[model samples]
Target: MTFQPAGATTIAAKTPASETARRNQPLQSFDLLVGPLSFSQATRRGLAFYLLSDGIAVWLATTGLVAQAFVLLGLSRLLAVAFGRLAAGRRSARRGLVAARRPWLEALLYLFTLAVVAAANGTGSFAASLSGFPASQALRVSAATAIDAAVGYLTVQGDGFFRVVTRGLLSLLKGLEAILTLTPWPVLFAVIGFAAWKRGGPMLLAVVWAALGYLGLFGYWAEALQTSALVLASLCVCLVIGIPVGILLAKSPVSRAIASPVLDLMQTMPSFVYLLPAVAFFSIGKPPALIATVIFALPPLVRLTCLGIEQVPLHVREAMQAHGATPLQTLLKAELPLALPSIRTGINQTIMMCLSMVVVAALIGGGGLGYNVLFALQNVQYGEGILAGLGIVFCAVLFDRLAGSGRKGGA
Candidate 1:
């Protein structure tokens, strides 16, 4: 059963002829199809130019350059419909001349009505603009004066609302300042050693304490506190609206559908767009900044709250239902407890978003670390800007870590 291989001469003799025949076959076929191929090429070239010109025309129309084309088309269609209707009405009345002439008269009437409507709309817009301009100016001046007066009053009294509220904060800082200033390095090391024993080990404790010492050396302690306060206030406002909206959306499908588009717009629109409206309404200062931050930061909380409630297990809901639990009771007991972790994460995200926005908000006169950072940027003081930016970052990290830890522990 042994098979013999072909010799090289025999194999070469047969190969080239077949190869030449196959190559020639394609040329023969091309000769037959050339007329059709030429026709296709011409057709394709024409189509490409046609499509390209059409695309350009469409773009021009969309951008308003060819707006008159659309206007003419609309008018033509309207006239055709009006004429048809008039003809029908006249035929029914057995009046040919009136039917033929009525369409033109109707079209003129429509044109007049359109003009009237447009005039009214234009007048309304003009009046609104005029009214809003004065109010906007008044609000801006009032907001600026109020903020300046408040700051000046606090500065003069040294015992105003801010001072009273920040007393505990000042005390905490003073204690830390005393400890870092007066305590021996060895005593600090000993405290670190104690923390290491309680928490993990000496290495972890050393890293933590070193970070604290570095922050102090960089003089970021006070800036950090101020940033924290700003973020806290922003998050509080975000939650006040976000959570309720979320709950409402979760309970009502109609609400969810209605709100989803608005949320999408809010979340997708540029953060800078928010600034103009905020300035228009609230004017520049912490309040406007607060409003912007809330708008920017609140979407996640609402979205997450709706998500968390929806994700609750059906069985758990059914169990509550079987036990004759009312909707509110079921939500309070079963749903909220399970949804807390998600809500907390949303809150954490809200805080982070607020922290990031505060810097942008500074452009519109937000104070605290935001103002400091903006001042540094404007004055070309890199050191000050970097320090203030880092202060904001530290506060964000601290809040995120603390909130995350609470979420984990609570769960």
Candidate 2:
């Protein structure tokens, strides 16, 4: 009988596929096994279980266990060397084995490590005296002399060049001062309106206004303005120095590697520690405070710039190359635009760091809300301290939100 097309199709569907047959017959098993271990195996298992139970606790108890472990290992080597010399009846040879190959290098390394450990442990004074020795003092003095001489030259020259430069700087400051005074309230409102109009809407705007109101209500308007000025100055200085350093580091792997640890140290160094050197060099004043803030706040910008530039996609770089772009053109057009968001984040972080340092800087004669806060604390005026602290919080939140929103808007 010849099957019709429909009947043939039904037959094909009804047939069991090889795949389905295999799926149905998948069950397989080997013989069940029980184990007995040799002494070494049992010991290994026991040790593993012991470690699993107590490893973290042990580590926590011996906080610097890794460093301690290295020291112990080195001691063991020294002992072996001593034993070898004694066995050979050449006791003097032991000294040769244990002695540093390059005595000066070893001494320098030891001093560096000691300084680092001391700094980390918060013995900053000890580290400073040891690490920042006579050479540092001499360099600092020379720099100060050079700066003074340059200032003198500028003041005395009174040539068109000096006059133009001085006038330009004065004009800039006047413009900034005017902007600060006149624009803040309007800018505040405008920012609120923008935020409300955008993603966060009215709720965020209200919060922003409420914060500004609190600053005003506490009679901190002038202080807040001063704080803002300092923040702007510090941020500008950070960018001016940081961007070039970041570019250089990004361009050279050797520089990047060398700079990485230095940046880490600069960043991790305590805010208070910054005050000591600042005081020693620049003494107690607004200038010293500004310098310290710049030093502390600048690292993140530099790091982020390097990171952002480095992270630009290879294909994007290649595309720039394919277009016959010069290095300068590629950097200006391609790299900078792509890296901007990350750089913005860095700037935001820098502003935040500056805010944090305001109080510390005040300890070294910086004025602003920080000075008031310190004064309140010293006088034990709870209300004053609280009010000043709140003012700082308000300023920080305002700047942070504005910067963050600006970044988002850019993106």
Candidate 3:
């Protein structure tokens, strides 16, 4: 029943749904090119080289036999490449051009790995060769011994210096602890409540008081004070060292590049790893605990400070210079002011991280809520451990909230 003009072409009675969608989105319509890709010149050459490498590797692995197999395999692989290259040249459209791909490289790795293991294990009648040995323990032992020797040497030579540093740290710890523990409880509560109210309003004030009340009611006030002292001491050390290092890194790309890997290592290294060197240098007690906490918590502040400084707007720096400001003045006024939020964030993160280490540091004679937790854990006292852990949590949050308070009263 259909009618058509004399020169008209026949049309499909029904268009497919896919075709209909493509018609609707004509600008976006395209075929997804899943690839068995057409070879480029580099790809052609790389394949040939890869085949040659494989042949050589196999020949070497076969132990003086099967060297001729390589020639046959190499010739066959090269011939395939040659035919592919010719077919590629005849093509007018590059239908299979694709993004970077090195599946062949991965294949090569697997082949080589298998070849190596076989050679090391001995191929049929071939004695195991001296090359490609992944199963050896002698090297590891020697390295461990060398490290131990170095640590021992350092321990012997640096005893006096370590002792002096330990004394200084212990004095600082005791001083802070004395002040915290000796202060009248009401005065301390008033100070905390007032600061909380001022910074975070009445809600924060209530939370702060509740946390403190838990510690006092459960007879954990003294331990809480000890934990705070540790955190505050560690915070001071972190700020003293971290800020300048951060500023230096921000200003100098070379220093930043060098320090970046070290910072990454510090942040990623297990907190327990620092404990050995700390214990060796400072011995067990508050000093070693402080050292461990400082190492554990130092990275965030440094990172944040550098990020803040780097994030300061370029125009602001230029404006400062335009006003005839010196480098110091520009940094002090323009950069630091603008970077304060980030810097404050860094400080708060450092405080929290510092608090977390308290429990771990307890393994090295760090007494406080952490000690209580550890003691309770050792005896399998669930109730005591949970209560002590809550005490630590309250201390952590209390400090974190205070640390996060805004300077301009809107935090």
Q: Which candidate should be chosen as best, given lDDT against the real structure?
A: 3
> Per-residue lDDT tens digits of candidate 1, residues 8-78?
12443567875533422311112121212443333332343234333443564676543444353344335
lDDT of each: 0.63, 0.67, 0.77
Among these predictions, the greatest TM-score belongs to 3
Ranking by TM-score: 3, 2, 1
Better of 1 and 3 by lDDT: 3
> What are the runs in model 2 whose C-alpha is more than 4 Å off?
1-40, 44-178, 182-200, 405-411
Candidate 2 residue-wise lDDT, 296-333, digit = tens: 99899999999999999999999999999999999999
Error of 3 at 367 (Å): 0.5
Q: Can you give the TM-score per candidate against the true fold?
A: 0.51, 0.58, 0.71
Clashing pairs in 3: none
Of the candidates numbered 1 and 3, which has the greater TM-score value?
Answer: 3
Report the number of clashing residue pairs per model: 0, 0, 0
Error of 2 at 56 (Å): 23
In model 2, the clashing pairs are none
Candidate 2 backbone overlaps, count: 0
Cα-lDDT of candidate 2: 0.67
In model 1, which range of ten residues has the least summed lDDT? Answer: 26-35
